[model samples]
Target: MTQKIEFIDLKAQYRALKDAIDARIHKVLNHGQYIMGPEVRELEERLEDYTGAKHCITVASGTEALLISLMALGIGPGDEVITTPFTFVATAEVIVLLGAVPVFVDIEPDTCNIDASKIEAAITPKTKAIMPVSLYGQPADMDEINAIAERYGLPVIEDAAQSFGATYKGKKSCNLSTIGCTSFFPSKPLGCYGDGGAIFTTDDVLAKACREIRVHGQKRRYYHTRIGVGGRMDTLQCAIVLAKLERFDWEIEQRMKLGARYNQLLDKHGYQRVKQRNDRTSVFAQYTVFVENRDAIAKQLNEQGIPTAVHYPVPLNRQPAYKDICHGTVTAVAERVAKQVMSLPMGPDLAESDQQRIVAALSEAVKIGGF
Candidate 1:
């Protein structure tokens, strides 16, 4: 085995942008306005421009973004938000935190995205919103979901935590639905050095509501307009994101090329890789695939100096906390995918040679695992 492959090469990314990142950090330190400083608004403005959104509200984390979005929409007790179970817990966690119900939906097996075709059946009079997780950094069926949302007069919130730079139908992911939320957790496509996130909205009222909700619902300092949370993104984190923006475009392109190459390589060996829709693109935050004997294969990869991850090992519907409430949701697909899904090392810094090595190792590991 050669040198170990990093699951996410943040070190390589930092080394490449050391100067810009240092400058950004130093500027933030000199200003000393750590809370809600100038960099916060600056990052919001740039992200708005990047996503073509009317407003961008910086928040403390991806979970905060979802919470703020839900609060802005006035989701509360007894209200339901339709979402998939095959995603990070945050997607459903925020809904539960707000005293709302997360109505679990099945996912498309190939894409691991919320199955839009199955969403309508779950919706009822209590459904206030449709929250779709763009699992694995590929936008879900937003157009279909949006159409369904329109008919029901329900708002759509896109959980784009893993897909800041992805596009769907010629539009950016975080700008697709009624309110789009993205994360800047260090491993995300457009991550900062630490936890951060943003909310994108075209509605002025909703945007204003989100902005206030992030800061304890204050329209002005020391004045309460409504209930809110202390969810503002830190100034330094915003600055770091701004610095990362310098190379973000190049990185997105690299992700596309690398993701395409991985698909090609994996396909040549008859591996069941995640599928991407033709009308959209995935940032491949985690280049996932299905396999038999997952644990044994992962152990083999580990022994061979390659890192592997399971984006999700259990569907939210099956989790101890959610099982009772989500009983009878009937997500056979999510349950099956959770067992077989595995993520390969992915990032813009990933080398093609490394991808070849990984694929070859995986092919052999599968054989050894009795597949």
Candidate 2:
């Protein structure tokens, strides 16, 4: 009936930080150091302190961050990495790209994150590590996952692309595991202007390896120490993130408040909102909820001018790209969640009035979809 509201409201964010953002871009332009520039180091330092992690290495993109982390771990042909199939393909794609096997596990139906209990059963002599995606901005049960990894002496990498500002039991998302990888693809909780990403870690050797891998495995300039990739984050993108950091705290706070408000609104209306454990706080990167007749509901919401999307309508194991790679069985919970999960408008700049509008429209849509 009316024009759809912006899903992420990036314009609102830009309007709020126009001057600062422009100034940051202009500074980058003035310096003309686009690759591995001063701002890159500055942002890395800020992010390290923010995450309370010992090291942070900015990379070309979130996917690149994952690749670099895997490469640094010495994952190679024939190795198997345990991960979920309900996440963004990059979680499993990177492992497969390295010639390593992506051992698909199922996710927790409520959280749509890797089920820690399912991981141990999937491991084998070929299992090298565990990579868990922080789906919809909530960390997986890291304490349990870490415990399992410690017992097996395996490394864990948190795919925190959606959960950068999220917290788990008081620890930051990217700092909760052996290595954490995140993306800044503009729509993320903490995004940059263009594609950029980073890897977080406390291990000195892993950190060093990641740094080397990010820059073509060079020990010094042009001196190749090992096989690697050209994965350095651009300076301009770093500057944008640096500028956004000025308001990042406020943005994250708004996200948490909005998430709680969404939960309250949905539960008040009798919607089956996804449960968030008390020990973990989701940044609500997607503000997703489950309902009957998801497709019909999404269509009705679209007709009412509220833009909505599915985080993933299909699990990775079911995808064409992954089916041939893994001949193993898929998790039932992940498949069920995939059919029901729908992401509503989410971002720091999403207005309360807009949220109310969304909730009202959605309530109507759900009733229509149920029919």
lDDT of each: 0.92, 0.90
Off by over 4 Å in 2: none
Off-target runs (Cα >4 Å) in candidate 1 are none
State candidate 1's TM-score: 0.99
Q: How close is every model to the real structure, measured as TM-score?
A: 0.99, 0.98
Residue 108, candidate 1: alpha-carbon lDDT: 90
lDDT of 1 at 274: 90
Compared with the true structure, the alpha-carbon lDDT of candidate 2 equals 0.90
Writing each residue's lDDT as its tens digit, candidate 2 over 193-274 gives 8899999999999999999989899999999999999999999999999999999999999999999999999988778766
For candidate 1, lDDT tens digit of each residue in 229-341?
A: 99999999999999999999999999999999989888887889799999999999999989889999999999988999998999998889988775237999999988899
